[model samples]
Target: MNRHESMLRIAASSDISVLLLGESGSGKEVAARFVHAHSKRAGGPFIALNCGAIAKGLTESILEGHRKGAFTGAVDERLGVVRSADHGTLFLDEIGEMPFEIQCKLLRILQERAVMPLGSCDPQPVDFRLICATNRNLRAEVHAGRFREDLYFRLNVFPVKIPPLREREDFNTIAQEIWKEIADHNPLNASEIALLSKRKWPGNVRQLKNVLQRYSLLKPYDITLGNVLTDEFSEPATVADTCTLYQAKSRRIAETPEWNLICSELSKNSGNKSVTAQKLGISRGCLNYQIRKHSS
Candidate 1:
């Protein structure tokens, strides 16, 4: 977090195109928001779009507005995300997922400072800082020809890599923040939080948030090593009463609709948390919260 904070402070003062590189759940979007909030365009709108969520066919129309007659579904003229973020910041998440053709258009926009809407004759001038993020190895993508070389270099002007949760030494602090947000009646005890700090979370902060949510759902709504670690918890804590604690929290799992949906999705996905999170259009953190909420 310190590394990112320092980089964000340095990047926020400039209008340079910045790229955030990290794992999917490593908080790239959050870092982008930080940069924008502290930048010169802080008063302007911050428009964020997930490139991976948009299909190739609609990418251009989405980035640059379309006239009413541009396409089959076009009902009115609109300023797309780029123009909407004029004088502000435009954050493109999963930027590496953009198609080759769209990359050309994006490069053009960055270079020319203008965008031509679909079915429109005149190019509207635009001025906005661009912040792109991706979990992909973009340099490798350029080598493999999956991502454009020019576009990669353009967005890579100021790259900031966000470290994963396990690499950060402040897991306990992060866990406490999550606990405060999700805990119903009480916060996790210090010992329980200590135990949580000892292990690694592969999914990064998103997974930690999920795990912390589970801790909040323990039988009596208090956190414990067993509730967080379960059989999957690593580097077992020195606390010897975790077994009895686990048994106590196993009394009953809430049967809410959300809980049922979570179970159904997990079963359908064969319990693959990452896939399930993607299918649900949410982060693993959110999915974990959903699971712990009902399966307590």
Candidate 2:
């Protein structure tokens, strides 16, 4: 992680385009902001737009601006995202979701360092750092003919893949820092951090921070991390009414996936059933009950 941060710091020193690759909720935007904050354009505007959220048929106008009366909704002239980002940084999230037709327009802007707004024949010069992020594999998208190959190569100049939380070696340290930040410097005990570090944390740091936030709120009421986490993993609010509650839960456990998950947790905890139960966000008693029932 330190190495990755160093790489980002280096990338910030230049105007080269950057492409961040990571799973959803894995802090790609945070990384982008880090680069922007450290870059020479820190004083300039930082314009962010989610390509996936761009409304269809309005991509050009939204990205390159539009003159007054250019289209049905163009009641007034507007400086779009590209122009707004001039002399600063433009962060495009979910770049892989950008429509195919708009890709060529974006490539022209990158190649020419200017934008010609809709209904305008003259191109207005734009100078800004480009940082694009996406969870999708752009190479695969390009191969599938959904993404432009030329555009992918342009954005992939300094690609950096953000590692997921579960794969980070500093998970425990991260949890500690988040607790201190959210809980007014009152640190989580070592055991609490240990229990937290054992979970898969599928939602990555975002999910861990959320769990810590809840734990911080409940800490003043004399609650433990185990209690907070148990509540965190409680069953969904809605369930089928076709069977008894216990039967429904047991049925879930009897399924191959759920049973395999339990076994996997047990193995990961080195055969320590209690630790496995904590990692699975269930009481040790419940884990034992299910294990005994299913063992037969």
Candidate 3:
């Protein structure tokens, strides 16, 4: 089996928490669903939570059940995510954003195999696996004290890292797969497929899906490479307008000093502002200011 298939297999048999690390829009949630579908707990519910999407104050109440009188607006008993994922899997997207306190509670539940609901005396047993994903480097966060080391270790068992689309060896195969998916929804000719396959998808699979969706709506009778590479592919603007902007930016970069080259290199290195600043032997704010100046 390929790496992706192997990952699914490992996730299927293991009850240990799996950490999926990948770039944004790299189909992390899709992989998580594949794991849950193939696992022994396939019959159970698959609960997904976006840690970054939830407010800090509501996170605890969301993870643990709340009694009728637990808080101000608690008029009825509410089932927390942990209880909701009873015999299935809890897929936590952007797990790095989970608060340290909530992480402690999560660690406790994973260690004890039980969850103590809010305003509840007794802890209820739960049999479930966790599949957490994050775009951020949790190790660095642990060192920075933004994330708890104990919680990181607890949730990082059987880690699976999904490569970005740009690094995928099976780029042609993936492109073909995306083409088939697009064709299922719309009737795209060979020219359109050829055009799409050549363009760099910075937004990855999600972006590809959106492109196909848009093309289907605005079905052009005669699709060409130029048409597919229009400004709509980048943003909501005319092709000429986007090209003008691109040319202007190119000219500005060309006119800049060696610092622009340094910034470009730094951006290629995952766009970590601090790292860029360090490499340039300058303060982070100076690097930021220079980048802003160049961008303007």
With a 3 Å backbone cut-off (N, CA, C), the pairs that clash in candidate 1 are 229-233
Among all windows of ten consecutive residues in candidate 3, which has the lowest summed lDDT? 216-225
Q: Comparing 2 and 3 by TM-score, which wins?
A: 2
Q: Give the candidates in order of lDDT, highest first.
A: 2, 1, 3
| TM-score against truth, every candidate | 0.77, 0.76, 0.73
Candidate 3: stretches off by over 4 Å: 169-191, 221-225, 232-296
- Per-residue lDDT, model 3, residue 249, is 27
Q: Who wins the lDDT comparison?
A: 2
RMSD of each: 12.4, 12.8, 17.3
Compose the digit string of candidate 1's lDDT tens values, residues 74-105: 99988899999999999999999987778898
Q: In lDDT terms, how accurate is model 2?
A: 0.83
Number of clashes in model 3?
0
Residue 14 lDDT, candidate 3, scale 0-100: 72
Q: lDDT for every model?
A: 0.80, 0.83, 0.75
lDDT string, candidate 3, 210-231, tens digits: 7766554333222333554674
